[model samples]
Target: MEEYQKLSLIDPQRVANLPTPDKLFLFLSCTGSIEYPGTERAVRIVGEKLGIEFIESVDQTCCTGYMLTCNAVNPQLALASTSRNLSIPQEMGLDVGVFCNGCYGYLRELAHLLHSNPAFKEVGDKANQALGREKFHGHTKIYHVQELWFRQLEKLTSLVKRPLTGLKIAAHYGCHYLANKDVAIDDAQYPTFHEEIYKALGATPVVYKERRACCGYSVGRGFTHREETVLPHITNKMLSAATAGVQLMTTTCPGCNTALDREQKTITARGNAVSIPVIDLSQLIAFALGAPVEQLGFKANTTPVLPVLERFIK
Candidate 1:
């Protein structure tokens, strides 16, 4: 058995088949870029530190998976757009690294459909016919940035200068990453890789009751059902985290970051005292790895992360 395989019997898929690529086509997330630009900046710093080069292309566009998730766009259009965006990385002969769970899950599923389903392959063919030069052959593998971090945990730990020695951090895996259980890197129901990463950084990983619950923002629930369902759902999740004494929270998805970070104000307004600062897992990793705080872009976060930073970041 491989060394990584021996680490976990439950989620061997996480480390057994994990790719440690030196170069990747970094798929930019619309939410991450617009809402938390620090995610990209932090990812770049981590990549540089880890000796991985992140490549970006202007030809790539939004994955269009969000629209499909919201039931707002035609399936054909979403597939075509995904195919087009994927083709850019395939042509460059590089796999994709996505920072958002939504992008990772959506691209992975759509690409699977294109490769496995003849009906979806037909749609991909039509999309290729429409595009003059590029073609998506479903050759590019999509990975969440957190998986990459796990793959390089040893090296990442070695590079940590600002260790989170006394902080209590919780992981929000988000729903999309494991929606397709067959392709997931960790156990869908009870993942511990995030906690493992926390340990690597010397931080105490807090386990809360609602750790596996959905962020309530997926599929447009935050917008369509904020008052009735979303607020209460997130309130419960936050209350559980707060009870667990989670001083900081990390997410693999920017949309979830937006929901967890921004909704705390609303939760406080509704008489819940939950205010755990939420950030991208990549940003936290970069912070621990000694990346400058100014580049991490905490300014855009709705819930101020300064208090959490002061706890560990010197």
Candidate 2:
């Protein structure tokens, strides 16, 4: 690549003189809806509160990462799907923002693969060409809404009507998000941004031993190793949270929320009867921004967020 060409591709500000994406092209994962509906509402409410625009496309499809991880589809198929989905917003000049760690990591990795390997690029290119759409040149960037919220923390702080007073909350940064630690906004081993986010919303952020631990279900690992690995892993993680006096746990990924929340109800059967409600970070922000309780869709949680509602939702 020529010097100017290389600079244009890497520089967000210089490339095409493109204005930084202000309107988030929100990408909701399957888990975001079927498992945790609050993520959708939370993103909308949080976007409204932050004065940031959010746009959704029906043409957008699942990131297909979960299927790839589960061995349902080969990496080639996943790459093709990503190329097509990413090409949609790339043509519209919008950056993609995902509410699931799986999608963010999955797409980012695929995009990286396409850029680094001519072989993968050819596969994606052929797929895009066959579909008769713009070629997927890996032109678009992917982000998590957590990063967006962190960027607009002050504005988020200003909108908090119901301060989460004395609500001891713990942050679960999923394995995929932490995978890119060197490029992360905070230390991956001990990130304080989520805790800072808690203070911004007037809540106490708890620190625990398993704060950075995996949920044991990444990429269908739970299905393969649930009995031997997943259960014991979650049990220990939850025990640490309960020990730290954490009342609620917040997740940026809906998949993480599903594992953490659903697993809480069965901790007792495993010999320790401890439970803490797990919710999406977006829902917490929405509640703080004064979105109606019904809009949060907390009913999707099996662990029951009622205690949280009873405490804060007056």
Candidate 3:
């Protein structure tokens, strides 16, 4: 078994380029789009608030990481396929921003491989040549939306109309975002982005054990491990959050949300109950930015967060 490497992503001091780029191509994810729609809505709403030019391509296809992780496809095939998918926006010279952690990791890792390995680049080149699209010149920059928000924390702070006031939130940093610690996202050991956002919105951030533990949906769902190993880990997370008195929980990955939110009943069935609502970091941002709760799609949630609504909703 490959040991999960512990990592911490440092908070970026500034937006890579301020005043926002004119255009950003979004590589939306399946889990985020359908299971945690509020995250998508939050990204759109935050982009609007920041005056960012955002573009979406329905013609674009999946990164296929989900299937790849399940060993359903060859790694080489996954690399070549991702290279083709990434080339779409590079041809348009648009910087890429993804809301999903899986997309962020797959796209960045695949792009890095294509850029550094001549053999891999050749495979990607031949594959794209067959498609007749321009070669992916490696001109594109990839960013997770958290980078944008952290860079523009001041702007985010100014937009808060309904301060979170005394509401305690626990930050759930999924494994993928900081998997490569040298990349340094937001202090993985004492992550501040999610907590900072909660603080800026006027909520208190809570810390607890296993704050960095895997949400257990990564490679366990397809196997019985989800019932045996995964559920226990998730149960621990819930107990920690519940005991800490956190009113809400937030994460950047949809897989984490799906595991924590959709599996709440299973966790409860194991003789553990979690009262705090699980939400995406994006959903919390949308609320702070004054978006209507109904528009944010809370109904899609298996775990109702309605009680916390009165705190943020005007």
Q: Tell me, by lDDT, which candidate is best.
A: 1
Task: Give candidate 1's whole-model lDDT.
Answer: 0.84
Per-residue lDDT for 18-116 in model 1, tens only?
887889899999999999999999988898898889999988888886668666556887788888888888889999999998898888888988888
Model 2 over residues 1-314: C-alpha lDDT tens digits?
00101111122222224223468687768888777877887888888777768788888888878667755546888887888888888878888888888888888888888878999888888988998988887868787878778777777898898999889888898877767654456556656677778888998878887888887666334455455556778889999888888899999887788778887666778788887999889898888878899989988888888787577887
Better of 1 and 2 by TM-score: 1
lDDT of 3 at 116: 85
> How badly does each model clash, as a count of residue pairs?
0, 0, 8
Q: Rank order by TM-score, top first?
A: 1, 3, 2
CA RMSD for every model? 3.9, 7.7, 4.4
Task: Write model 3 residue lDDT over 1-314, tens digit each, in one string.
Answer: 11122333444443345336657998888889988787898888988888877898766787767656866546777766777878888877788988878888888888888888888888888888998966776657888887777777788899987788888788888877677465645555566667666778888788766677778887584334558777887888788777767778888888888888877888887778776688888888888778888878888888888788675676
- For candidate 2, the TM-score is 0.89
Candidate 3 stretches with Cα past 4 Å from truth are: 1-19, 222-225
